[model samples]
Target: TQRYAITIKRSRSDINDEIKNMTLGCNRSGYYRNRLNLTENSRHRQTSSKLLNCLFKLFASRCNNTWSFEVRNSEHNYQPSKDMSVNRMAAAGSCPHQILSTIHLNDLSLMAISKTIYNELYSIRQERLDSRTPIQALLNELQGSDFEFEYQ
Candidate 1:
């Protein structure tokens, strides 16, 4: 079931902001992130970041639009867990480290999306402490390379 609420928080906020506060964004590009909940934060941050990268690639390849999103001020701390979200997020290219990488490509779409922003909570920064984020795998794959990506 979907639920909604309106609360006065001393400071003003809109529905979008309210939704952001209620849960970690389905995607990382948003005003604020739910920082306290490590389980949800990593779960969302990793999956959402990978998903953003996926979307960026999908759009860049099919269309010529330049997609970009700002980076969050803070970073995520990765800890090993037995949680189901971990495996799902891993498949989606969500890693704590290796947030960004030099693709060494001149394509406008990739170039625009790779450009970094400051003082924001937009997309995740790539820090590849882990083996490979989904972005790297996707980027390296040949066009039309088929692979299975899933969650749960």
Candidate 2:
């Protein structure tokens, strides 16, 4: 029920196939259009190039050990939609990977969450007045992140 992780060292190398395979990135593509029509397999095939590039930058930044996330056995528990039944089915299964990992032992959650964040950040950067976390708005708060992180 649980998945495992692989570690990588960042000496500024190109991203390998398996790690690239693990990132979910469909909605960021042109076809998705905020629709839930595509199946999970189709989703994984087109990972977010933007986020992958972001990860590439992250990988190149520091000469230290970092997490290289991938998820296997995820077709059983990964659904990217607003459907409750699909999510219930997904929850019944075991998901052992971290958020940084491929949202499953696949890339569903990682891709979806990253896509959402990427969109939100895009809206913020564009100075959208209605954006929940606008850049100018964050400049006033100056607080911690909504998600928790450990200082390693």
Q: In terms of TM-score, which candidate is strongest?
A: 2
What TM-scores do the predictions have?
0.13, 0.18
Per-residue lDDT over 33-152 for candidate 1, one digit per residue giving the tens place of the 0 to 100 score: 546656754564453232221111111111123333232222322221111222233446654222223222222222112222121112223343135667665655534468655433
lDDT of 2 by residue, 1-152 (tens): 23222233323334652232223322222232436677667775765332221111112122244555443222322233322122233245523223224333454444444444344345444554455556545654445556543432
> What Cα-based lDDT does every candidate model obtain?
0.30, 0.36
Model 2 residue pairs with clashes? 25-48, 71-105, 71-106, 72-105
- Top candidate, metric lDDT: 2
Off by over 4 Å in 1: 1-64, 78-152
What are the per-model C-alpha RMSD values against the true structure? 19.2, 18.5
Evaluate residue 14 in candidate 2 and report its C-alpha lDDT on the 0 to 100 scale.
Answer: 40
